[model samples]
Target chain A: MAGARRERDIHAATLELLTEVGYDGLTIEGVAARSGVNKTTIYRWWPSKDALLGSAMVEADVLAIRLPDTGSLRGDLESLLRQIAALLTGPDTSPVVTALLGAATHRPELGEVVRRFFADRLGRELPMFERAVRRGELRDGVDPATVMDLLAGAVWVRALLRGQPPRPAYVRETVDLVLRGCTS
Target chain B: MAGARRERDIHAATLELLTEVGYDGLTIEGVAARSGVNKTTIYRWWPSKDALLGSAMVEADVLAIRLPDTGSLRGDLESLLRQIAALLTGPDTSPVVTALLGAATHRPELGEVVRRFFADRLGRELPMFERAVRRGELRDGVDPATVMDLLAGAVWVRALLRGQPPRPAYVRETVDLVLRGCTS
Candidate 1:
């Protein structure tokens, strides 16, 4: 129980540092100072700064998302997208996401984790689209899985690349564009 | 003449390091060692690592793209997507892009440069879609620019996250989905 408490404390300290300093600027020394854990103990649990930061990032709010079921593809997608947009804009998740994305470029291991995190989330939410496909509401040969990637990629590009917030209307239109096709 | 030659050599060395070390592991010291330039000289041209990296990256192949003047929206877009996809997957540009994207996550200054890069690219390309809109090729209320975002974002997501090369077929389907609508 004492060990668990210490671990939680250290993780919390790391998260605090992440928000303050970002991934690139974060240091194990800072984590040690902030958490009151000896640097050796941190090194014992995590091999490198990247590992420690990655572990700390896992403690952030990214994985808590629950899929919504609104009984239709559009409604369900809209809800999921709204939640994602909200998360991207949310204070707790934004910096962590930004940091993780930064880390993933050079660190393929972290990149895999980020990819898996997205895949896992998409796994839960994609059934909504699958349902629509099964009901003949979508076009033939349209990949349900790829749709989520496109949706997410679009929103993330807007958020990360363009510095734009994922507007609710933008989410809706993106969903509509994917499901119904963008044609007249 | 000596100073100009030295500056060019430094930038070239930095570009090489950009590929070898990537954005995260890249350092001024490393650049100096690689370029045979003193650290102060590297810092003299660029104030920080991000700025130096941004300068190096801007000199990479990304600037070579020209918005095609092919007649018709589909033709122009297909050409653009193909060229963009080639640039994205192209060896010289890929590592530079990956590094720039990672840097943008943490460095606001670099982020602005990256944003301007995309805006310039997308800004030029979007008018092609607008011409389509005027020609009634797309539906009412659909912002040609937004559709352009979806298209570009979709391709970028696949490349960035999935590590999958953008297929010509995927580009075809994406263009079709955006322009034709997907509903049966």
Candidate 2:
């Protein structure tokens, strides 16, 4: 297999087993078994469990969220939120993240990784808000984190707390609600 | 201890142990040992671990959130968000809920309890929004769930995802944003 493909497989396998057995039970050998990639290859590419977890988590969450550039800010926000809603209700609910978060409450190293990973992911969404502000869709001085949090947070509240899939209608309303709040 | 105080202590101890040892490790005896109540007394009330956990989780999350009616919708919301922010950033960071939620993805019984607990908790906040709409503070037909998920979700996003405290200012901004969104 190609090197990039092998890396993708390894990361995918790592997350798969991570969700299944949790962070504590995850092993490179299991990842190798799942991915059919060599454990030695995984170690050679990523030196430690933290390194592997950090890379996989960042790759999965940040890399997957492509900021859609719809002509209007509403379109852009709606598009972005729809993707996030899907991820939140989809495979992203893997207990591994929850299990890791649960452990991160106690484990500082894991906690730091989880924190940095989300900070980076959340930060990446800032450009969308900046664009909206530039286009006069959002009021001047609107904070991206605040907007993003309200938007994504709505999806999360439903998915995480309620365990409900945030349907398409819900996504549209959330975008509309947040946009109105920010612009008006 | 009196009946109410004893029950409170039992729930407190149950949540404490649930966070420390998780739902799997939690037991009636453990609650008894921690709360200074006898196992027989605990069983006489709760009957099973699920029953005990159901009582404790609901008591801790729902019963703790007292919606302050500060006359206006804005004040009431701000007060409510402040209390929720405290809980989300405070002791509510207990891994037991996360652990139970994670387990709920696979275990049906646990899943129902967790879902019902949050639905009931979320549902209890509706009167505030109803009052707001009645007072003309919010637009007619504003869905309480949407507003609430935005408010509480913002807190959860900061607390759970970023591992950061939802400061007073953040809580205030969230209420402001959601209120503006709804009213405008």
Candidate 3:
């Protein structure tokens, strides 16, 4: 329990540092000082700033996404999109994602972290369609990626490309219009 | 005609250098050497590297997106997606766009360039729905951003998040399903 708690603190501290300083300004020393974990202990598990940031991203409870089996496609999608918007556009994590993406564009290792982060998050979100399938709400053979492309794509473009904070009206309208048919 | 040709050549060279060496590697001197444009003249027109890059992006022939009024909603969308995937994922301009985005994340000045680039490009693309709206093929008052969001989001996410090159089948299937009805 103590080890688990300490790791969470370390991850939290890393994200906090990332948010405050951007990617280039982040240092393992800064993470150590912020987390109160000794530098030697931090280095034992992670050898580089990239390694530490990757671990923090992959292992963070900051991504507390709860996938609800809302028994219908619409409800599940709304839950999923709202959660994603909150996570990606929220003040705390938005800059962290942006900084990581900037750093990841240049570094393959950090790129893997970005890939894994999306894979994990989108993977968890994909199962929301299962209940819809079971209830005949969605077409049986619908490609999950298609649905993801529309929902996640809309969310990302709205946030990143347009630079708009997530709006409830936009989210609701998108859910209604974007998911009219998960059938292809 | 010679002056216009010279400017076009400069923008082309800037994109080539950007794709080859990336953002940090891109330099005004390199653009000058590549384009055969004098550094003093380049400096006279654009004060800094960011200015050069921004001008090159905004004023380039690289984004030759022709919004054809194919006389139907589906036809227009398919054309739009196909062209975007080709331009953004094509061998020449993809890395240039990627490098610019990474650099723009931190620098607010460069950030304005990115915003303008998209606003200009997307602004042009937005009128694709005009034919649909006029033809009564799409719902009246349909938000053009929604349509752009679904289409562009899929394209960008495939390239950026999933690391998959755009597929023709994807472009077609997404047009079929993603744009089923723009009315919300």
A1-184: candidate 3 lDDT, tens digit per residue: 2398888988999988887887778898998899999988988888898778878887887767778777777778788789878877887677777777777776666676677777776677666766566677775456777777777788887877667766877787777766662222
RMSD for all candidates, in order, please. 5.7, 3.5, 3.6
Chain B TM-score for each model? 0.69, 0.82, 0.85
lDDT of 2 by residue, A68-166 (tens): 888677887788888878766665543554556555655567877787887887788777666766666776555678777788889887876677889
List the candidate 3 regions with Cα displacement exceeding 4 Å: A20-30, A38-52, A69-71, A181-184, B17-33, B39-52, B69-71, B181-184
Report the TM-score of candidate 3, chain B only. 0.85
- In model 2, the runs with Cα more than 4 Å from the true position are A36-40, A60-63, A91-106, A182-184, B36-40, B60-63, B91-108, B182-184
Window of ten residues with lowest summed lDDT in model 1 chain B: B54-63
Query: Which residue pairs overlap in candidate 3's backbone?
Result: none
The per-model lDDT (C-alpha) reads 0.72, 0.74, 0.76
- Per-model DockQ: 0.49, 0.44, 0.38
lDDT of 1 by residue, B1-184 (tens): 1276676677777767877776668789998998888898778778888677656545443436667767667777777777767776788777767777777787777677676666766766777767777776666777655676677777887777766788999888777666655556
B53-162 per-residue lDDT for model 3 (tens digits): 77788788886677778877788888888988887678776777677767766665777667667687777876776666667667554577777787888888887877
Which sequence of candidate numbers ranks them by DockQ, best first? 1, 2, 3
